[model samples]
Target chain A: MRPPPKSWPPTKGSEPLPNAPRIAPPVSAARPAGKLRGARALSGPLPWLLPALIMLGLFYLYPIAEALRLAFTDARLFDQATEPSLDSIRRVSQSAALPVILQNTLVYTVASVLGQLGLGMAIAILVVRAERARLRGTMALRTLVLAAWVIPAIANGVIWQLLFSEAPFGAINSALRMVGFAPVAWLSDPSNAMLSAVIATIWQGTAYSMILLYAALKSIDPALNEAAAIDNATGFERFWFITLPHLRAALLVNAILILIMTLNMFDTILSLTGGGPGRATEVLSLFAYNTVFQSFELGRGAVLSILLLIISLTLTAAMVVFLPRERK
Target chain B: MTFRAIPAAFALLATTAPVWAEDLITRNRVGPADAPNALTFRLTAFDLYSADPATAAHFGDLFTDFILAHPGWRIDTQLQTGAIAQEQARIIEQTRAGRGPDCAMIDSSQLATFKEAGLLAPMTPFFTQEQIDDLFPFVREGVTDANGDIAALWWFTDLRVLYRDVTLVPEPPQTWADLQQAAEVVAAQGLEGILFNAGRDEASAFDWLAHFWAQGGELVDDTGRPVFFEGENREKFLSAVAFFADLVESGAAPRRVTALSSYDDLLASAVAGSTGMFIGGNWMYNQIQITMPPEQAANWAVSELPGPTPEQRATGTGGWTIAALTDDPAKTEICAGIAQLYAGPGNAFQGLLPTSVSLFEEFETFAGPEFDVFVSALQNGRARPSVPIYPEISNQIQILLGNVLSGSMTAEAALDEAAAEVMAAYERL
Candidate 1:
């Protein structure tokens, strides 16, 4: 059996001489040198990515590895006698407050994610579907929404705490009293503390979801909508079949990001509740922090942190597997 | 050989000359008639001390006056905090490398660690015997190193008190039984009787320690060994714990008292009218005055912490101490002199306390009536156990007490467990 022709540089002569080795012409020719040069220029900035990767490895990866190691060691601030053991892990598992903390964390995360996403989607659709004549003021309104996102998390917590203060002097309580209602202890009551935190977090986080969904909504082809309309399809029908699918990728991305952010929420909770009202609003992050700083149980605190990391990683992995991957 | 010998001779002279001069300077500096020459001194203020401009100014004035009296001395002061922990770590690292601070205002607890590490200089030579006698005995005991040498001087004192609303309770409770009865009345009127630090942390331990001590319970024996498990003291402590548990469970105290992680939390609860009384210290008076309205502030008053038995009345006194950290004998003496000036009677150290004995004699006023209770409490205060393993012991007490109060463990069982843990820590120490 003869081997197939080699695809390489073409032969010098066109005519075949006696017993000339069979050679095939190049199947597809290269592009012009300018095109190649343009591609090279585009790839030139890729080297800058190395520094960013190195930073992530140092600041993010190294600390996480260290935390995992510390979690398994008997590390405490003052107590020198405690040997490393599974005691902390056992304590965490058997903790009476564990179930409640887990429940509260999940509830806060899910509720905030759904509430923010729904609200953000509605606002995004409104702004996109608005007539051109009204889009000017609508754009300004979007900017105002973005401003809420711009406030730092700690500052947001402070503002909400002031607003929710139980005293009659508080802004919300004062307003409630003016309307002939009794003042409510927003922070001191366990029933209200978690809900208060959720509201504050959602208020700040919804803008983020809105921006992503809005960008996705704007990118949907108008021609498809026009075609749907000509076929007597209603606005709702167009959104359901055409626009909704277009936003599926963005929604999944936004949901996963929001879930991770909410799961790791600490600053706002620390400033507002400090896991107060008898640990009613305690989340995993705050639990980990108190274990270390307040109790000086570094090993136990590290264990909690490791658990949080595992949960975050598992959820991220699930998102990757379950969400529809975007096609090129 | 001649050149090398010349360098060696000069080096020996150079080193020995300073030694003789230092000895001569020290001898002359302490003479009755001749005053020491002015020395340059540097001091650093902790963030908490520098929080208020007036407080900082007063400290500055006191230091300047001391320098003015000592003709050869000039004082330099720096205000710092964020780098405090790092600076402390660096000091230890440097000491291991053979260097450290001249003087530092260290927490009384940290003094134990430093003393154990053999990094502190004894201040007996710097302070005269009469001056030492004038110091509070409890403060003197707390500042003494294991070798019986005075290693530091106490700058300020803190003590616990039971603060109540005068309009609501009229007279504050003075005994444990009275407090329980008053708590019932307060609860009946729809207000919390007392706010306890039930959080599982150091504050919780400190709060509970006051109660435990008030019941005549000693966490450790005279020999500095754990003895919380056996004898009448254990029963008395458990009885107090039972009373506290009853108070919390009967809805007298806030049901969520376990969530009170900070003094600010208690203050907020009191200001919100959820609580009518709280166990706090002199610090809370200033905080309350700041957060409460004038009318509300007027309604508040303080009294000595209630005792388990009338004879068992006791308050724990703990505070910051200033210690010299340098190896140089002359510099250490100068730093000690500076500490003496700050902590000396009738000086700015009195200002550090809102109701010190000196403050009472000089100002003839307290920050408020709330502070009077603190003054009395301080007058009758017993110092907290000065064991080096205090942090670990405190943690065990807090966890055990919290569990007992929460009904997860019986008082006897909790005490046994805590005693065991404390003994383990003591052994390690």
Candidate 2:
């Protein structure tokens, strides 16, 4: 209004229009020479990483390579006549139980991952939404969940075994009988043993998944929710679009971790079943263990372990490829 | 941290080192210089014995007393439980690594394997001929290697006996036919006739072998091949399986019989008063005493296992053995000495009968009325054939028998299949 805000070009080396806010010229868009120098100075100590690299090579890389080599050869711990042969692989391929073991392993891994994720997410959301007065109790409950994870796997198996013992003297059977229900054989029966092991594993593993997902859920920006609400987005939509997208990285990390853990699971299976009742619940890991330790067919056992590793790595790589990367 | 904290952290370890060193030195010393105080020797047993604290404690005390009476020996003890395969592997590895214990308790059947591995030293060098001659033929033969070396000293001998409830039957059966009739009688009265483990493993195989042997079946013919399913033995064994199958089908025994993998679980059923009869070893006496009330315990009595014929009154005898693993002859000698003292007649409190024929007479007085059944059974018992391939052969038999008992296969078919498997395994060896 006052002379149209002095619409004129600035004089050379003179301060621009007084009424207009002075706009700093665009930075060259390149870092300063001093900053580049400083970055080079900061990176000078990176050569110290060599020792740790060497240690990893010796302890981890060498063993893994040796195991891979052994997997291709026949190596019996007790039988000296067992020479290097591909017979172990052929045996594994011809195993009648191979298909069933693979199916069970996959079912266990998927069920465990999904169950842990869903339950963990719900708990994390509630804890975040809970009022200050109720927060302390929720925190205590979370700690209790974590405590189960801290127990040794063998001890966990024994405790569960007592709970699910087939005899009337067992805790679960006694409780069921008191309720006027016929006692169910929780462990001896083939149908119930695998399920019982899964329940035990879930009781111990859910805490690990929950802690990671909770951190991811809490780190999402509240402003995004407000903005979405301003646009009249429904709560479900906001969660699907904003919350879930934010948690993508955490979920992928947790899934891979859970997959590795479930694939390598041994202690609980060993303590619970010992691959008994005519091998009703023999997982691949336990099968390998029996071949190595019990039967002393070390070469065959090594081959089975290598196959397991390959399967696990393949699954992990697929997960990494399919999962979405976080936005910058 | 200050230097004071470092010493404090190691205080307990520092003080205990000298005491342990002193004990080791004293334990190694023989003759007059040996410590008269009770010296603790750790023994690992199969899970069955190690699970009972009373048995372990009783055995420990027995050895302690025996050692105290000697001039330069003492007995102290610890017990560990592990699977047979696992324990054998661990001991073998330890011996090969040159870090084996001075002494260990092993299953009698493992004597051959131990000797073949060269892990066990001959005990004849340590004991006088009179001492070796004093042992029973069954015990002595069971622990001797192919080379005639006494590799182990028998302690607690396990012999099978038929346990029955007196309330169910006025008089126990005296023959196999009588037993079958008694089973039918018991079943009609709404009670289980007999309980035996039939799980496809070593235990099941052993149980079947006892019946097979009782039926005049030979484990190995002169050709060294298992005659388990051949000729007359085949018919007798199949007849036994048919009898069991009839009981299972007729609801005399539970369908879960095949699932009862462990001896303890089978014993538990008896203790719960669910079954009227069971086949078990001497240790079952202690188990029944602990698990059953005094009144029920009174009703239970042990009798010899009835055979197909009167002359076939044979039962399988097995037991634990103490063997040495040290290269130092002196250490080996001391270990053998400790074992002898523990296994001597005066050490009857250990819950193990003496293997020495002369020593057994001294402990006969301790048999008590309850032990009369076992003492009588031991008179006619035969040790299982001690062979290196025993475990594998037994496992195959178990699977076949389990299939027959579960009605998954015919008795003849099961026997034939098992025979083939055993032959194959033998050939491999």
Candidate 3:
């Protein structure tokens, strides 16, 4: 008696056993179509996702296409003439504002994502640890963080503005004065203004990451921790080996979402700094808004919106491709 | 065991019969809310109409008179709280959709753009030649369209004044140098020396325009091209920026001035007793009186905006205008009549000066010393250039002020940059 050749996966073009289960039905065979129509040419999820596809096409695809069309035209907000030209592109390209705005957007988004992720991970772990130890008031802590998350960005802007305002109006400055320290220009200085905006965004956005990472943390088996303890694994070693590997997918999802949110952030910065102290906190989204509404140059604004859309999509695509490689 | 549905329906109709019958009369028979007139006048007014009791009462009186003639003329009003520019933008959108209100209160500077868009019906059908003659020069100029028709009624205006806390600044500064020194003294005393609307908004641009005008600088030519950077005008522009730059650099004005977008903000600081002097509109003083304690309000007074020298004087006057946006003659007439009810240089809602010849004499408070300063300021008062490209110029100027105030760019560099941006936009036009 002999074991046949020990190759596990069948090689290409290898013959299958006569009694082996058939891989799907033969294409030549006809199947009755009721619910699952696998054999059909238009098979699988496309039909199931038709409604969402239609929505995306109508809302997302159409707006992007229209914006692209408008980008090359000379359009003012109220003007009816729609002559196609490169003036919008030329204006944005030659604009001194573009460089400053892009830099601000980058700084704001990167700082916000990093802050949200790191603070979120730490909070999520602490809360889970406290719950395991039967600590009280963890629910209250969660509610407070969630309160910041639930607040509208515009309201957050006003709240942060009052907190960041100078001497008499701002609590922060008043406290510094009480402590016999010179008041920091939280909203007046360019660098300070950007920092203030980033900090405010992080506070508002950290809840999103915390909830996601918390769910991931809960999914991690307590048995694994016990086993690692039995192996005499240190606290850091257990977290690095058992907990972090389990959270890889959530962290990736959280980073991508936070990146998109921070990139699109405008309402907070708008009310907080209004992109001032000399365009120091002016992100791309706000720049586009000012171009269209404030400056009334729709063509140039359209050009800026397209640039923003490209950056958002490119970053999302990169995260999709790059983040998964870490898993390997 | 159950009641019949018919009786319940009958009871419901009986309960609402009066309301339904009244509504039917308003919608179908004669006038909606009033007498026999079959028209409803829709107006989009600023927030004061809805928010201020005095303003609402004044309109209430006007409506009482209107219904006597228009009998059955129902009034429907919508209120907006945004600044004039936003209100104008909203109207423009509705106008494009062919669904604008019969009447809209717009910023005076918006008149030119509205006319260019063909969104306004000529006010000549409403305002008479005699009425036109009575308007302030800037109002007359602003309301007149390219075809020489009065397009909108500029009812009230506010003049930029040099506001001072009398305790901090004994006398109003008459010139830039005097202002600089006075503000320095205030700043040295640990008070905010001066404040102005310098944020990226119409107010900031409108406020800064006086500085250029005081130097005899013109922003645009007859062809609507920007002439601000040409020859001597360039020097004037440079000098104007330098004057403000000096205020910021010498600690006379706080660096926050670059971001102070609204007179409302300056008013807040003034009422809190932190501000020493500021250049603000006359309405700001009126607000101070309303919100500040009498003793505090007494310390605040307004004078005409200072100039390069005491003899050189100029001021910026901005006002709101009401326009008939509908082509329906009947609706337009109703709109015109409504506007005329409160027409003159008076606002019941805010204590802004009349836009034209006085009709506010009925109110004795209009005779106050602050208004006397406003009256003199009217002599040099000018409206913003209503040309469409003026917004672009203002936007660039906003950036320039921010740059110079931050000490990021020199005055010359900032001016050149602003000029280049404005010219590029002009070329595109």
Best by lDDT: 3
Pick the winner on lDDT between candidates 2 and 3. Answer: 3
Clashing pairs in 2: A75-A299, B39-B76, B40-B76, B41-B76, B134-B357
Which ten residues in a row are the worst by lDDT in model 1 chain A? A6-15
* Fnat for each predicted structure, in order: 0.06, 0.14, 0.26
Q: Which sequence of candidate numbers ranks them by TM-score, best first?
A: 3, 2, 1
Docking quality tier of model 1: incorrect
Instruction: List clashing residue pairs in candidate 1.
Output: B38-B72, B38-B73, B39-B72
Listed in order, the DockQ scores are 0.08, 0.14, 0.34
Compared to the true structure, candidate 2 yields what TM-score?
Answer: 0.76
For candidate 3 chain B, which ten residues in a row score worst on lDDT?
B23-32
B1-429: candidate 3 lDDT, tens digit per residue: 257988988889997575446532221122244434333333444322445766655555555556556754655555554645556676787778887677777777677778778788887867767777878888888888889988887878878888899999988888999999999999999888888866556677788889999989999988888999889999998899889889988999988776677677788888788889888887777688889888888888778888999988899888777788887777777777766765631264446577666455656657778778888889999888878888788778887777788777888877887888888877776
Clashes of each: 3, 5, 4
lDDT of 2 by residue, B1-429 (tens): 799888887997896564344422222221223354333344664321335676545544544444444545543344545566667666766667766566777777666566656778777798788888877888888778667988888876777788888898657778767776776788777666777766544566666566677767777775556675778877877777776677677665655566556778768767877677877777787778778899999888888888777667767787778888766666567667767756763246555555655665677544576566777777777776766556546655655555665555677776776676455445534
Cα lDDT of model 1 by residue, B1-429, tens digit: 698899999999996564334322221122112234333232344321455666555555564455445554433333334323334444545555654446666666556656766778888888778767766667777778889888887777777778788877888787878887888788888777788776544566677677777766877788777676778777867876787788877767754555454677678777887667888766787777789999988888877888877666777676667777776677677778776665543233343452225434555444445455666677667776777656657656665655665555787877776676455435435
All candidates in order of DockQ, best leading: 3, 2, 1
Task: Indicate the residue-level lDDT of A52 in model 2.
Answer: 85
Worst window of 10 by summed lDDT in candidate 2 chain B: B23-32
iRMS of each prediction in angstroms? 6.2, 3.9, 1.9
**Better model by lDDT, 1 or 2?**
1
Best by DockQ: 3
> What does candidate 1's lDDT look like per residue over A249-319, in tens digits?
89989988988888888878876766655456778888787666544466677888998889888888888
Q: How close is candidate 3 to the true structure, as a TM-score?
A: 0.87
